[model samples]
Target: MANVNEPTTNYVILTPEGVLHGFSQVEPSEQQLALQAMLAPEQTMTAHEWVERYSEIWLDMFIEEGWVEVVDKAIIAPHVQLDDFLRYVSASLSGSRRVAIGSDEGFCLAKMGFTQQEADTLCVAAADFFDFLKRQQQRGWAVHGHAISFFSTIDMLMPNTSFIFLWINNQGYWIIIEDEPLLNNRAFVELVWGIKATGERFNLLAEQVLDKKAQLESDQQAQAEEQKK
Candidate 1:
């Protein structure tokens, strides 16, 4: 991987989008810079391979006590690792209705409506005990609601380490302590969404799916009315 301070030897051609010209090229941001440094060369990985490798690293970092299954189909951009994940959390999802937390050692993204103290408390809890997380995971408790976002530790230079993400949503709170967070966001959102959008991954397809479902329901209703006629 290239040093963060070193410029490329040549102006390797890139698209108008200004994405990097190297393997696993993403947007040219600090997160991408860090990611390019930390990750295995993209030439050596397929998309699926990236996901699997990320999950493995995450498990090693966070699975102190319980079993964790990375929901691959549920994530948007699964290629993202730790640094990219934190950039998303700190810059993107910080103030949104949902909360997200990310670090190089481990990353956590959660939706939130909790007070700052509550949020801080959750962070403390995650930082303090590995067994507590395990019990909650085994009980199948929801971590996404109104609880809090938590990040136990932050270590920039470490590899294959651990972190925690607490995501709060309308439904509940969710805690993900993995080696990395699946940091996904929209191009427009990353540039314009501001601080609150930082930590969690976003899915453009989720919105599309919701629209499609609504259209299907409308079509069904129309068909039913025609049958009555």
Candidate 2:
């Protein structure tokens, strides 16, 4: 049996052949097992089964360690910013035709080997398609209710390019490549979680600023009233 008090070593590697390998000194817990099952190509457990087996405490630890993020009562996978996340994605999808990051508001944050105008156009198309998907769900056409991640091979906007779309918080990311997709890749999953965590941090900072401004305005109003009295 492994010593409970002794430190354990865990490592993950992405081989040049694109195979992912992971190892741990200690046996995985039920939660870890459940997560692994969910990550499998032929997922072993349903969402409900996975939820039942998953541990909230484990999730809390991931959040505390900045591996996961919570935003507006929803969880965004991996905690990372736009720039760093893009870098990781770019490296993972090396030699891709184009890789772009954008928001639902038709704003392109960054792109590789593409003009700003082209990026913007792609973002708009993604946003429109996302909206259309939601509308279809509302119309009962989508029996699965909603999807957190999806892809499109038909490039209606950009010719000769296929793209994958991932939604992180209120933002969207696009990876345009010929035949490779990052939807199930470890790097892509990390990008999603990291971006969500970044968004949460920004929201908290904005809230603090707004609260401080409100307090200052109240203090000034009190001082003026006292002087008038």
Candidate 3:
């Protein structure tokens, strides 16, 4: 673990293709896992707080990674600036404990906690996903009905602001902000490890400040009734 003196670098890959998506009862072998991604610190970013982090820090990372380019004042949220897409990829699922990862080639698993190794793994995953998004853009695929727009090359013409692109899955996506505040504190969702948009499991987001599921269930039930009618 980096001898305690250096800043602890942990790897938190929010993907299910790892060594642990299946085999619920058994842990996969190390060779199947990204040993560098051990566990992330057990903290979550509250919905609004997550936005704050994006504005303050992560927005820059997204820019550096080619995920987004500061566009206009976030027409969505005033305090939160707007970001246009550079590349997009999405998928979804939620549930926690343990990290599993793999591509078409293989898979492995890691426990969810905090460690330098986990951070390193996350770093690699972040970089890989960034590249993946770029590839998807070049292919001219319409992701969520929108085409990719690379903003990194035109920073001189466009102002930089903090914004986040999100994750989507077979189900939907995880979002904390809406036109209206969902909670008394205005914190709809929180990401302990920053933003849990990896589309893997909700484990990273389950630890929450507000229970939005109650509303989700109600919406589902209402939709079911309407369908029957």
Most accurate candidate by lDDT: 2
Whose lDDT is higher: candidate 1's or candidate 2's?
Answer: 2
Give candidate 1 misplaced runs (Cα > 4 Å).
1-78, 81-122, 125-201
Please list the C-alpha lDDT of all candidates, in the order they appear.
0.33, 0.49, 0.28
Best by TM-score: 2
Where model 2 places Cα greater than 4 Å from the true spot, the runs are 1-85, 94-97, 143-162, 170-178
lDDT (Cα, 0-100) at 4 in candidate 2 = 89
Q: What does the lDDT come to for candidate 1?
A: 0.33
For model 3, the superposed segments whose C-alpha errors exceed 4 Å read: 1-94, 98-114, 145-188, 192-229
TM-score, structure 1 vs. true: 0.23
Clashes of each: 36, 6, 39
> For model 2, how does the per-residue alpha-carbon lDDT over 140-220 read when each residue is reduced to its tens digit?
884231223333545443234455454443345544443243444556555444544566667888999999999999999
Give the clash total for candidate 1: 36
lDDT of 3 by residue, 48-167 (tens): 333343343543443354332232222121121111110011111111212222221111122122144653454344345445555876798533321112233455443111111233
TM-score of each: 0.23, 0.53, 0.21
The 10 consecutive residues of candidate 1 with the worst lDDT sum are: 11-20
Give candidate 3's TM-score.
Answer: 0.21
